[model samples]
Target: MGLIDRFQALFRPKDRENEPATVAMPPPRPSSVLARFNVEQGRRATVEEARRMYDEDPRVRGIIQTLARDAVKNGFELVVEGPRAEEAQDVAQAMLERVDFWSRIDDWVRLTLRDGDSFLEVAANRQGDIVEISRKPTLEMYVRTDEFGRFVDPMRAYYWADRLASVSERPPDHAIYFAEWQIVQASWDRDEGSRYGQPLFASARKAYKRMTEGELDIAIRRKTRAGMKYVHSLEDASEADIEAYKQRNQAALNDPFAAVADFFSNKRTTIQAIQGDARLSEIEDVLHHIRTFWMASPVPMSLLGYGQDLNRDVLDEQEKQYRRTLEQVAQWVTGQFVRPLLIRQWLLRGIWPDGLTWSVEWASKEVSTVAVLAEVAKAVVALRATGIVSDETLLRMLSHVMPDFDVKAELARLREGRPDEIWRMAQLAGGQDGAA
Candidate 1:
């Protein structure tokens, strides 16, 4: 079959083909008006507001950037298994390259966590191959699903607001709808049974507000009250006298040059520096709020340079914890975004293997995964001498030792390279098994 034909077959299952992508949903406008109704939604902060924080606040920006950077810093590999596993791997890699997937991964990762949800639009060429994978604004796109959480018909996903050009042609919020398989979505910290993903920084809003305000308040206080605001008190002086004194020193109060001009005064005005005010030594409460803001997000305080007293042991512990976090984030990305695109490319190529199972593996950012997994591989390979574990099983087990190793293809190569040796080894393993 042709590429376009296969593409249609892959996404349009017989049962779901007749159904629309969406139905009976109201027009989705880009506004926070619905926020009042869904008070508990996204920790009471609208997705729009969260996006603003990402742009304006350094803390929010840092947290999201850190998540994206740390998540993909080590890179990942796709492991495929099936009769045509090698072909599938080759095709998937070529497709990813064509669309510049890795090159623009930062954008995808940011979109994944920017508004607590990510929406990706898959664009295909005339030959029905995916050529572009671009991000749609999470704030503008709306998803409609049935009671079972499955997509409705052509309206499964909609993008942009209802168009001003023609309401009839683009009725669903005037948004152009996408097919079930056309859009790839990834949500961060999503709430159960909710359509939209919970933004990772939703809970940090209040603390961020306090932290930012505290810093600003503290800054203003330091500049204004950090030093003495001299009080020139007049003892039994008339209003005219006080007015004359102010008129004379008004320039000195504002301008340093004018202060040098304060040569003479009628009375002995003892201008004592205002003592015991704006003591910055005791603003622990504001610091507490700053720490609280960092604590609210997934990015650890140490990751953002907050813990000054962190020792090597403490840092190692934090690194271990962070590695675990990255693993989870990688899994979510593989499942929601990466895997689906691979499958889509497979279908577009019309050579996708049936019953194909695959996983994306990552190199560790902290620990040396190869050395650690190599030891595990050694243990697994030892089982092969017993004749119970097959060579293929051993290769799969050792797959962690080398991220790009294709188990099935490597097994085939070994069989081709040394047929007699393979047979002899099998016989020897059988003898060992019998002796055992």
Candidate 2:
């Protein structure tokens, strides 16, 4: 097929006439014996509620945003490795600059982290240039899969004042799907063949709620006076008098700007301040819950701005693990999002490099100190001087320390006998030979 034809085929909606028209209904609950309950409806409701909470809940927003930002904070660059690597890299760079690929991916990451799954619809003009890319919420889209659990079609429902007005099938190939985790069932017939993804915070909802409550309790404690027990003699005071006295005391205590005044009373009321040990314990419990949340999430405590007392080695290991996860996400994004868009862009422009294979390289999560970089550079230079490795190898080693360093450009300069300033400085230093 030609480029347009292939693109069309990839996105063509299935014929509605060929298939039985079935109204979309919630899948039956697995717990139901007769399959009367629509558990899928409940799940959809839950996902919707979770989405709402993610938007409204400050703690949820903070946690998810932190994860999303950190995942792509290092950012990513497209790397093409093959005979036409340089040409492909140039194309990738152009595509990035034109489209703001990193920013788009950052947005996608945030959505996926918030919703557990994110869908992007790619629209191209007749010239094959991507005109727009938009995100579709999972709540608005319903995916259908074949008997074998493969995606068949996705339907988008439009709502008018929260009532479904029309349902339209999205062109299959026009959408890119990113799911962090999928819920698969053994009996595909019993469930929606398309996988359902739950957000990372879904399981920790209760813990988060408890932590929030604990924080609120602490705040209330900080603002309010400690509880006091009043011992009043019933012999002299009527119930009405006792009630009035209690109300006055509460009003005085609750008023933020009220000043305390000692009053002499014949009732002989002895007041003692409530101990704050319980409030402190509750605060500790909140911390425990937070730690539990960190354990459940892919993010480490250090990444979320905790773990200040952690040793450097431990923090490094945690960051390494987190970066590894981001790297995997980068790989998945490259395949699911970048590749197809780039291919479409290339076909539109009629520019296809031979043996083109592209991958993504994330910037280093750990910033190397100058001392560390200098020491590593010294070792690499020594190795190069001993003829143990070539200049290309040295450049590759330095690329780890300085990701922006263009190894290919440096190699080309060396081959053409046009050394850069660094090379000239090295030569000059060597010529000095401690003469000064």
lDDT of 1 by residue, 1-436 (tens): 7443455566654654666685566644434235312433343346767787888988788888888887876567677888788888888887889998877887688766877777888888766578888888665566654334555454344445532212122334446666666787777776665666777767777887887888888888777666655667677778898788888777777674444446235866656556645477677888888888777566778877677889989988887788788888878878777878887777776665456877787755554364555455445535755889776656655554454445556677777774345434433533333322
Residues forming the 10-long window of minimal summed lDDT in candidate 1: 162-171
Model 2 ranges with Cα > 4 A deviation: 1-6, 9-43, 81-87, 151-196, 213-260, 266-280, 283-285, 308-316, 343-354, 386-397, 403-416, 423-436
Q: Pick the candidate with the highest TM-score.
A: 1
- Compared with the true structure, what per-residue lDDT tens digits does model 2 show for residues 217-250? 8777765644443344434677786776666676
Models 1 onward score TM values of: 0.72, 0.67
Model 1: what TM-score?
0.72
Model 1 per-residue lDDT at 348: 71
Clashes of each: 16, 0
